[model samples]
Target: MVYSEQQIMAWASSFFWPLLRISAMFIAIPVFSGRFVDNKILVGAALMVTFFTLPLLPEHRAIDVLSHEGIMTGLQQLLIGLSVGFVLQLVFSAIIFAGQGIAYSMGLGFASMMDPTTGVSVPVVSQFYLVLATLLFLTLGGHLVLIEMLIDSFNTLPIGDIGMERSDIWSIIAWSSRIFSAGLLMALPAIVSLLMVNIAFGVVTRAAPQLNIFAVGFPITLILGTLLMWVTLTSVLGNFTNLLAESYGVIGDFLRIRR
Candidate 1:
């Protein structure tokens, strides 16, 4: 059974292109992207997914893997995968931002520790929210949905020079603002509640100058902030769900997948 050079290249291209996209996605997505997950595991998972996905992918035109065109095609695949993962990454970033805001409002801004996921220092409050969001993300099968979208993209976008368009890039940039807006929305209730508490402390300080706000108000503010967060925690999951849905919609638009 002699396989011609063309036939061999076609098989290689089939595996290589999809591997590039799937591997890139694994490197960018939230939970899997964390340092806790071993690189070897990621590679194995990417390979496994590519193996399964190859059958579902459309027939490929044999392009030499070492050719200039092949390089461009690989880049396009990488970009497509990264873009999809990046959109969801922003949603998690928003969750972190909201936690940071709430921590600062509660005067716990200084109470920060290193995040194992991103390897950066963040407030304990933010870390708390991050854990919850991660759990929710997994529980809701968000990872599965992302993989399904990526598979669908091969049909809609295909592996070629024609990848993400100018409009798609602009949409991602514009959607990046979600980190601030969505975060602000999540933190707003706690922020406003804390602000009012601070204002009341200011009034008390003004009416009674001898009273030490640092000694008296600090503990009270901390207690109140905790209570406020407990009360508002109920809505955090709801906010995340809405944001996740919006992100999926954005991804669908760019990937040309109908929701």
Candidate 2:
């Protein structure tokens, strides 16, 4: 049971760094990141993974855990974990964005529901999209892939204070625009069809001033929008697959750039 201070410090550092990184990721990424997931569960999972992974990790340099360098190193690990999670967050956001757009176009913006993940009232359409995407993501083994990538990051980036570079930051910033664009693209078909329906209503109102466009147009738009949403459902799976593939690729590139 006799152990020197050096041996204890080495053991602590090995467990400490990886735990910090893993916990930070669980705080930022999906399902596990949600408020529904308890803090104790997340910490326990981090601890289990850290123990399982410690043997594969590199030797730790003895440094005072309370020292300035140690603090900086912890921050760097946090940043690395957040960056990886942020990329995936963008993918889910795109689905939510598209859902909102479609809901608005279908005149269902007022149909709001509390989002379990965000704890905010969002259009029911958006909620549906989020649920569908979550199921699809799980079906595709996205969670497993994400975990694998998280583990691979240690090998690619190593456990150190080598935080993301300026270019890496810029790349993440630039890549974020894809969220809006991809979302718009997903909702485009529905938007366009709705737009045409509105135009037709406009022409009818103009040609026959006696017609109550408000009365007739509302029902027609709602009906058409619902139908269009069903038609667009098929495309959603394909788009989600592409977006997820791109998201994972971006993650890989992000890690490679750090190297």
Candidate 3:
């Protein structure tokens, strides 16, 4: 079939723009961006998704892929995809913060390990929370929901120079404060319980200065912290669910997706 240069550029532009958005999303989203997932597999998956999503996307205006206008459009799509993923990433960061707080309270601050997902050193308590959060994320089908939202964004957000505005960026930055607020809420139980335990120990130390409170108090704090965590684990999962729902709402708002 003999196709004109305009027809050829049009076809390439349609594929190129959607691919940029999908690929950028895969590079930013949590599970897909982890070290366990190979780069080659991620690219292949992104390509496959882009190919399928192409049929669902709205028709694009023909623009030369090498032109300045094309470059700006691509950047807009990339930012939209990244912002969606980044908002969710903040939820996980909040979970990490909660874990760290609990760990410090339990006198386990020295117990650190490298997280395979992000390859960063974190307290063992934090790592434990991370594992549960990851499982909950998958069990709740969070990954699937994110992909669906990304697909929907093309219709709502479209490919153009118009994208996230200054207010939208500010909203995301404001939402990031949840890392501390939500984390504190999650860790509050452990923090308060441990503080009371420490207070009691302080009272005993004053009563018996020769008792060597360090030796006696350390083990008791560790045991109490473990028990407290076990008792509150269900509450932690509930908090995560609420946080995840909030994150989805933020993404929906940012992408202009209804519901």
Predicted candidate 2 versus true structure: per-residue lDDT over 217-246, tens digit per residue: 888889988898899997976797799888
In terms of lDDT, the best-performing candidate is 1
**TM per candidate:** 0.98, 0.94, 0.97
Tell me which of candidates 2 and 3 scores higher on lDDT: 3
Q: How would you encode candidate 3's per-residue C-alpha lDDT over 1-259 as one tens digit per residue? A: 8999998898998998888888888888887788889999999999999998888889968877678998888788888888887888899989999999999998999999998778899999999998999999999899889999999988888787587798999999999999999999999999999999999999999999999999999999999999999999999879988999999999999888878
The number of the candidate with the highest TM-score is 1
Model 1 per-residue lDDT tens digits across residues 146-215? 9999999988988875978999999999999999999999999999989998999999999999998999
Pairs that collide in candidate 3 are none
* Prediction 2 TM-score vs. true: 0.94
Q: How much is the lDDT of residue 155 in candidate 1?
A: 88
**Each prediction's whole-model lDDT (CA):** 0.92, 0.84, 0.90
Least lDDT summed over 10 consecutive residues: which range in candidate 1?
Answer: 57-66
Clashing residue pairs in candidate 1, if any? none
**Model 2 segments beyond 4 Å from truth?**
257-259
Give candidate 2's total backbone clashes.
0
For model 1, what is the C-alpha lDDT against the true structure? 0.92
